[model samples]
Target: MTPIGTQELDRELKKGSAELLILSLIEHRARHGYEISKLIEERSGGVLKFNVASFYPLLYRLEERGMIAGRWVEKAGQRRRRYYKLTAAGKEMLKTQRSTWRDFVHAIQVITEAENA
Candidate 1:
């Protein structure tokens, strides 16, 4: 699809920033990759979508860095799914990242729409 409206551009921006968003989501709860993708989309009002290939490597890297923990869970006669949860270190990091993200967005909002200039 061709790039279009402001909402579309907003989606593009969120897609580019999805790794941080996913980490933020899982910092609260352990989520499988697909579930993370869904929550990003849902929470963002359908503005964020993550491709599996891009999303998992970042998840693995965060795990490797001890920023997050991953586990595989299996149920009786069910599929095993990888779930990601925040480590204490990850929660600290996420607190900082979230503050940064909020500040960045607020700065943009202020510049773009502040008092209608």
Candidate 2:
């Protein structure tokens, strides 16, 4: 049984980490929306999932903010899919976000460990 506070914390953590997760996934290459969703689920060991309704808007928002760029691509036999890639700004954002997340986790660890000790 999960406590209410724990559930709330889970939601907040997911909201805060969504951008970093998405940005890191596409740091190396462009990926379509579904592929990104699958990777997140797989990599998280089924602990995290993003549906299209919420996921697409996040992608569009990132694109609009110039953190990412999207273009339609079609393979020889496949339908066109809009793939997203990190922009120069996104690389910088990723770097900053990575540092921020690391600091945040470290702080949480210190506090929790101090409380336990």
Candidate 3:
């Protein structure tokens, strides 16, 4: 098998965590696609970025899976936008994913620390 380069590894890691990131973002309130994208970029300090082609598909997939609910909102003098919020299933999934993520990170940290010792 071909080895994964740094860029490919980064992409894979981002893909693995994308659902968790999205769920956490909308846990409190609903957010439109653009808002979500910008928030992710800003919060990550531009280390992570998602364009329309890649992002919308993930949103659609989550909506289809019942993890998220999206509704169209029309504001005065503005185009209609679909805002997304976490569903009950999403909340449950988020809880589980967060726990798993913490455990995985801790394990990785332990291994790396031991290797450096």
In angstroms, give how far residue 53 of model 2 lies from its true place.
0.6
Residue pairs with colliding backbones in model 1 are none
Estimated TM-score per prediction?
A: 0.80, 0.91, 0.95
Write candidate 2's Cα lDDT for 1-117 as tens digits: 956797678777778999999999999999999999999999999988876888999999999999999999989989899999999999999999999999999998999899687
- Give candidate 2 misplaced runs (Cα > 4 Å): 1-4, 115-117
**Per-residue lDDT of 14 in model 2:** 79
State the number of backbone clashes in model 1.
0
TM-score of 1: 0.80
Residue-level lDDT tens digits of model 1 in 18-116? 657877888657888888888887887865666678778878888999988999998899789999998988888878878888899999999999889
Weakest ten-residue segment in model 2 by summed lDDT: 2-11
**Candidate 3: worst 10 consecutive residues by lDDT?**
47-56
Point out where model 1 deviates above 4 Å.
1-12, 115-117
Q: Which 10 consecutive residues of model 1 have the lowest summed lDDT?
A: 11-20
Q: Is candidate 1 or candidate 3 better by TM-score?
A: 3
Best by TM-score: 3
